[model samples]
Target: MGSLTLSGRTALVTGAGRGIGRAIAIRLAGEGALVTVHYGRNTKAADEVVTAIRAAGGSAFALRAELGEPGDVEALWDGYDRQVVEHTDDTGLDILVNNAGINVRCAIGDTSPETFDEMFAVNVRAPFFVAQRALERMRDGGRIVNVSSGAARMAFPEITAYSMTKGAIDTFSRTLAQALGPRGITVNSVSPGIVDTDINAAWLRGDEEVRQAAAEVSALGRIGRPEDVADVVAFLTSDAARWVTGQVIDASGGSRL
Candidate 1:
């Protein structure tokens, strides 16, 4: 199971309280990386994840910071500085997974400025800013995996804004891979299809008709679980993926066809 060995490294995962974020954080810790689970506002959820990681005999800690805000980013960095630098002395972060994002379901006609701003803030701007911060502390061989979605390419009537943000992430990842190539850092995006998570349980697994349609259309013949996507993300953040960068691996069971 530990094919992607991240032993002796440190990882920071954003929005790691629940759903896909939590899955990724747990997987990274299980692979022997010291994981810091970051949440937006869910203290209890973050603590639960930390507890689970600890129970699995892995090193983990719970951190909270609001996504898409400069103040929150500073606070996060300060906390990381105290906790990580004091322990490691070197202060170089090994892995950063930008898995936090906001999805707004609004058609073009119904979209408001505030809603658009909010979506872009968390989905688009936050990743870029976080990546910038990560680069400052990342070593030469650090890995950055940004969580994207098939909606970035698939045209959905009510998810235009959300798709735009994801599209930007795809582009951002590719561009960053090139920018950080000389530094030996890899940047890639993992686009998941319809994943069965608490956030979208009703759409992907609970609703019989929706599940049937997704299964019939997908080549894998089933909806994706959080662990399914989490496994791929964990791989991309490992040494095997060092040569593979600036690419988007679709973990969608062939759904974007």
Candidate 2:
């Protein structure tokens, strides 16, 4: 691919403050897309991502809005519209990465109603509404990538609710792709497994035994990195993936196979 495959395009990555989202933002910016780094609460981390992008000669700015709350989608887009107008004098977006989601590690029996509701609120409801609002601002031939999980396909009873949310995302991608096909827009979901990010640090970082267990889950026999998933996302947002839509591409390093 060319160094600036996405030159002059505008992209927004939710949860861009850190982890896989951060990697996606940086990668897109490096490919010459003006990026909006959306963060929920970590102002410092979000600002740092913007700084890193700028320092790398890429353009980016940070926007903050906690997801899963009342009016969260509107608040996020309001900020996004203003920032995009100021930066590019356009209110349309070229790429939308719905990467923000929360996971609650509880089995069905142990999961409370409150916890279940909260997970759906953030993982399912927020992304659905965010995409609904984003479609209004996305330009023709735009790209939409929802970050999902391998747990959605394989049974992981420990995070049954979280897996359900991801399954919903995959379904959302398929239906939305058909709806937007006339506009040449693509909607797809990516499922990653056992990535070594802060969210998994508690178990995967210090304990060698736990780390090895996680690694062995992947056929590659190694822990997946944030960039591993980010690269897949970057490709989906590029023109090369124009003919690809409504598919749930797995970035799981052959996990469970």
Candidate 3:
């Protein structure tokens, strides 16, 4: 490969205040794209990302939005339109990484309507709306990457509802891929396995027995990291992956088969 340069493009990454979203935002910014770092809460964390990106000599700005709210999501894009014009030469989004999501660890029997609704609102509905609006501004040959999970494929206990949303994202990616292919855009999903993110630190790090069991099941003999999954996402969003679309690649280190 010569180089995967994104010098003139712009990308918006939601839930980019920390963890996998943070890593993906940084990775995209590192490739030379001006980035809009979106967060739901914790402006501090989002600013930290802005500081880190700026300190690394990359262009980035922190923007906030409550993903489940329609107005907030609209402000996210509206803010992006103004930010790009104010900060960078580009005026449109070339990449949309729908990484903002929530996980409700509720089993089938214990699942509540409120819990299920909240999860879907953040994980499924929000991303759908984001993509819908983004399409209007995205140029030809745009890229859309939805962060999915291995749970979507496996029948894991206590996470059935969360898994349902992930499966929905995968299907959405596929359909969007076909719908946008004519426009020279690519849509895909990156389904990460049990990665060592703050969201799962309790089971992946806090419990030694569970940690060991997780590692043993993985071919890599260790837990995955934010960067591990981010690397795959970066590739999918790059020119090298131009021919790849509607595909879900597992960045799980061989977990969940």
Q: Give me the runs in candidate 1 sitting further than 4 Å from their true place.
A: 1-3, 85-87, 202-206
Residue 86 of model 1 has an lDDT of: 46
User: Model 2, range 112-141, lDDT digits (tens) per residue?
Assistant: 999999989988899999999999989999
TM-score of each: 0.94, 0.98, 0.97
Clash counts for all predictions: 0, 0, 0
Ten-residue segment with the worst summed lDDT in candidate 1?
A: 82-91
Q: Which of 2 and 3 is ahead in lDDT? A: 2
Tens-digit lDDT track of model 3 for 1-257: 62467788889999999899999999998999888899988999999999999999999998888988768668888778777788876567898999998886778999999999989999999999999999888999888999999999878988999999999999999999999999999999999888888888766777889988988767888988899988887887788888999999888899856
lDDT of 1 by residue, 87-167 (tens): 455667999999998776789999999999998999888888888988889989899999999998788878888889999
Error of 2 at 158 (Å): 0.6
Task: Give the RMSD in angstroms, all C-alphas superposed, for model 1.
Answer: 2.0
Cα deviation in Å at residue 203, candidate 2? 1.7
TM-score of 2: 0.98
Model 3: which ten-residue window has the lowest total lDDT? Answer: 1-10
